[model samples]
Target: MRPTRSVDYRTLAHLRLPPAVSDFIDGGSGDEITLHENTAALRRLRLRPNVLSGTGVPDTSTTVLGTPLATPIAVAPVAYHTLAHPDGETATVRAAGDAGALTVISTFSGQSMEEAARAATGPLWFQLYRFRDRDVTRTLVRRARRAGYAALVLTVDTPVLGRRHRDLRNSFALPPDVRPGNFDADHHTGLRHASPGHSAIARHTTEALEPALGWADVAWLRRITDLPIVLKGVLAPADARRAASEGIDAVIVSNHGGRQLDTTAATIDLLPDVAEAAGGHCEVLFDGGVRDGTDALKALALGARAVMIGRPALWALAAGGGEAVHHLLTLLTEELSDAMALCGRPTLADLDATLLAPATPVCRHTTTARREAP
Candidate 1:
């Protein structure tokens, strides 16, 4: 398929999947105001162009936690890849490896950690959703580390699953043959059974997740593996500062693609504030509403070390599996280079808030060396 833009893949994915399944992938939490705003806020930020500065085709390579990326984009962790295609995380990993981008494997990944790791030709970070049982959570972490994952990305926003009306309307549940390749029958029982009018995903988390998951638990996680710990789902500047002050390696400024909240501030709007709060403390990454390279460039100028593609990657995976995902990222990086050259910022080092219109605030970065995984 000659899909020229990211939305084309989204359209193709909608056509490829069942209506209910597509909605499950596409829909956000109640009202979805936050979901729509995530992208809208980025579009609202006006970029100022610079005159000829001798900048040619821009260089897009950068490092996150000491790992190199061909571009500043990483594949965000989205659940149930096999639900899109049978290859699941294996295909996704291969695509990311080929593009020289990072892949964060969801705890609920459609394939086993071992399988995903084996398929990876690039660095991998495991996104952890801690279970009520410490042992179960610990096991998943050790398994990921053993599988050669680079870091642990603990999702802290979801104390409880949010209300997704689409799942309720569709009564979405995993097909019998497809289950998270990571968990055994004992811990993931809720995933296997679906009740009418309720999403199995909600049931699974309600039954197994730690609703009172707190900062203490984060400390506990820090104690066990010694992997570089990155906190995902942060939107508040105070929370960003706390994470950095507490010795967390990185914090992703995100709103869970508006899937977890109905009316929270858009990630792009919050990024500059969060970046400022965590200034020089830890690397600030971003993960909301990144559809193209220009959107990525805006996020970088706002002080994100990198941006992650969530639904966009899933849509690509659904439309054409791994190949589509690679092509989409390649296009995005090229666009980013084009944008950089146009803005007189030929390299990532040359990006700063001055490239943005006066309405936007500038965020600065000061990063220290990251601790390697043991």
Candidate 2:
């Protein structure tokens, strides 16, 4: 087969995968209520650009989890990257690193944490999905820290596997050939029996996924790793407050890319509440439905310290391998810069809630008609 030239990742979703795989990745379960909501919520927010403010050269530079980043964006964790490209996490790290963006390596990555770390030039964070055994979680955390990961992102949204109907209908399973090099077969024994569409590893590995995973667990996890711990998948203001009170480093306001929950508020819609709840006690990051730079800007304007993109990176990698991924990141970063200039916002700090307004007409229809009459 001839090699495909790099195309726009956002525009080239069609070229990325077979129909079955794409559906599994893109489609959510039941009515896909949350899946659609994540994107739909963005439409509800309108950008009210400032014209007179001299944007000059906008500064995208920011620090997330206390680490410097060229842009306030990171790659969210996804499973089985080898399914997208042979290079897997290695290629992902390089692309993200080259762009001076952070890469959050998934717990189920095709490459080991150490392998991905070696390929990175920019900062890296290890995405941790706690398994059944405390030792296992500790082992992974220790490994990530040893491998030079700057922080630990504890994925809190997935307790039980979300119903991904497409994957279920397709009986989606990683072909026997693809595996996460980081885990030994014995270490992941319980996960082996999980049926297609269900992640036994995710399910069997962590028994502490209940509501009991409160301040104590957060404190316990902190005891094990000096690396900053970021709690992912928080939408509730109360929970955000709890996270801040617990002395965690950051919170990733996400909904698991709309995979786990079915009817929750969109991550972006909930961002301001969470940020307010945080009260500047901790940094707030965002993920879910971030397809382009406008989406990134929307989250930033709403008070997200940084934003992460999930499926887009996989689609780009699958579409044309490493170079394609490079192009995809470049496109997004450039788009963000363009957006900032047009809005007359010179830096992320200049972004505020006023930059967002409802796109709908301000006055009622009756009011408009009354004004028009002679």
Candidate 3:
């Protein structure tokens, strides 16, 4: 079937990649309660569209940390796009640049930060999970700056990787053809093999990611670089307020796409509170379960300065590489624009809490009489 939307791309991606690889991209953490809630919460939101409000073409443009985006949709940082396509982050970067969307390249990218930045025609941000070696982490930050990346996305949620049962069952390991180009080859040993019932990523994360990382590191990071700092994976309002006070340029209210820990609150449900807690001191971005234009609109109305799509981008990459991703992004923005026009909101400024109607309550059981099982 021809792909017209992100979900369609997901279907194609599922067919294109190997089963284990597909599961790695699609599955969340244990039980996947948060993953389900993220999409379900957005689906339940009710929009109160104004009628004949003289709305015509809707403006979907917005700026993030002084950078102008043609659309408020941005690509979230995820590792190893090469697992989906051999082009890896390079393809995704070029596609996002062409679509006028910002791309956040992961520390675990299949291509080096320099290569991805060189391929990008638009602004780029580097997503860092601070390594145990402060010097090594600093070197990465310097490299990102030297390569023309505009910001730093400090991901704090993943001190250690979560237990994804799908990967565990599959005993997932990276193929010899793919390596996280950002690091030394010796570092890839864990990625190339896995014992039965053990995902290689669990081994890799243990060896590389820092679990003792603390708020002090955040301050230390602030001391070393002038790049705008965006703290991703924040779900608590207290943390948002603290981030604002600590000079964070933005806080991405995310549950790490429900990949880090299961059953965390859905990002959309917590967005408004997080935004409010920031007290207008910093931008509030969002990630998690944003599937379509209406989903994006719901996030903006709730308080996200922008929304990032992770799995959908991977799905697009699998479906075809950079071109498919570009098409998906273009279609998504058009869907957002269409949604805005229908909601009687003509521009980004027209989006606010008032545009959303109170959510209709959903009962746990059926309201009608139940039929006996046949």
lDDT of 2 at 263: 90
Pairs in steric clash, model 2: 48-355, 131-205, 131-206, 132-205, 132-206
In the range 1-374, model 3's lDDT, one tens digit per residue, is: 87877888887887889999988888888988887778777777778898898898988889999999998899999989999999999999999999999999999899999999989989899999888888889999999999999999999998999888989999999988889889897957789899999999888888877898788999999999999999999888899988988899999999988788998888888999998998889999998989899889999988999999999999999999999999999999999999999989999878999877876455344432111110
Q: Candidate 3, residue 214: CA error in Å? A: 1.3
Best by TM-score: 3
TM-score, per-candidate, Cα-based = 0.94, 0.88, 0.96
- Per-prediction CA RMSD (Å): 6.8, 6.4, 3.7
Highest lDDT against the true fold, candidate: 3
Model 3 clash number: 0
- Models sorted by lDDT, best on top: 3, 1, 2
Candidate 2 regions exceeding 4 Å error are 1-16, 186-212, 358-374
lDDT winner between candidates 1 and 2? 1
**Reference-based lDDT, residue 315, model 3:** 94
Poorest lDDT segment (10 consecutive residues) of candidate 1: 365-374
